[model samples]
Target: MARRYRYPFNGKRFIGNKNSMEVHDLDNETKNCQIDEIKDEHVVTFIPDTLEEAHKQGFDNGAYCIGNSRR
Candidate 1:
């Protein structure tokens, strides 16, 4: 099934939760990422559609989805 995004702001490859401030790879998200678990109010779509942009907004790489090794 195709995944449906809430904001889909810039159609970026990454998705993040405002509540947790964690960003995940939309194409490679794992079950642990819990993209579906995030509330609609917490869902965030980056404007620039880049990891750096997300980071600039205080979002961090998802430990489960975006690789834990990289901070």
Candidate 2:
């Protein structure tokens, strides 16, 4: 059987095969974002915060692992 999943954001639920999560600053600045696949996978789509932060967080080229494994 295919896996099913739901992501909750601001008290709302989004259903889909792919989940795009984003974090924006108070002034509407995009901080970091990621796209999660339904098969328990995720990829970094955007990390406009900074390259230092991205490197500190161990993300390469704005793409990396999701749960525990590297993508």
Candidate 3:
């Protein structure tokens, strides 16, 4: 068996070496967990492209909404 990684462009991959780690797409079991983790951060919406950038944007948007909600 072989662990295939995404191409070196806009793809993300799991971290591991040969005979050590298994590199595969996010499984269904862990998908919910990941979603839960992000949801815990109060991220109402996020882009599916990049977590770091999109999450930051979501956080910022959340903050803005919170700050202006009373108005």
Best by lDDT: 1
Scored by lDDT, model 3 comes in at 0.25
- In angstroms, the error of model 3 at 43 is 4.7
TM-score to native of every candidate shown? 0.78, 0.22, 0.18
RMSD list, candidates in order? 2.6, 12.1, 15.1
Residue pairs in clash, model 1: none
- The TM-score measured for candidate 3 stands at 0.18
Off by over 4 Å in 2: 1-48, 62-71
lDDT of 1 at 2: 21
Q: What is candidate 3's lDDT per residue for 1-71, written digit by digit as tens?
A: 12223322113322111221112222212432232233222322223433344334432212211122211
Best by TM-score: 1
lDDT of 2 at 32: 33
RMSD of 1: 2.6
Of 2 and 3, the candidate ahead on lDDT is: 2
Give per-residue CA lDDT, model 2, range 1-71, as digits (tens).
11113422222122111233322121221223222222344422223444344444554332222223234
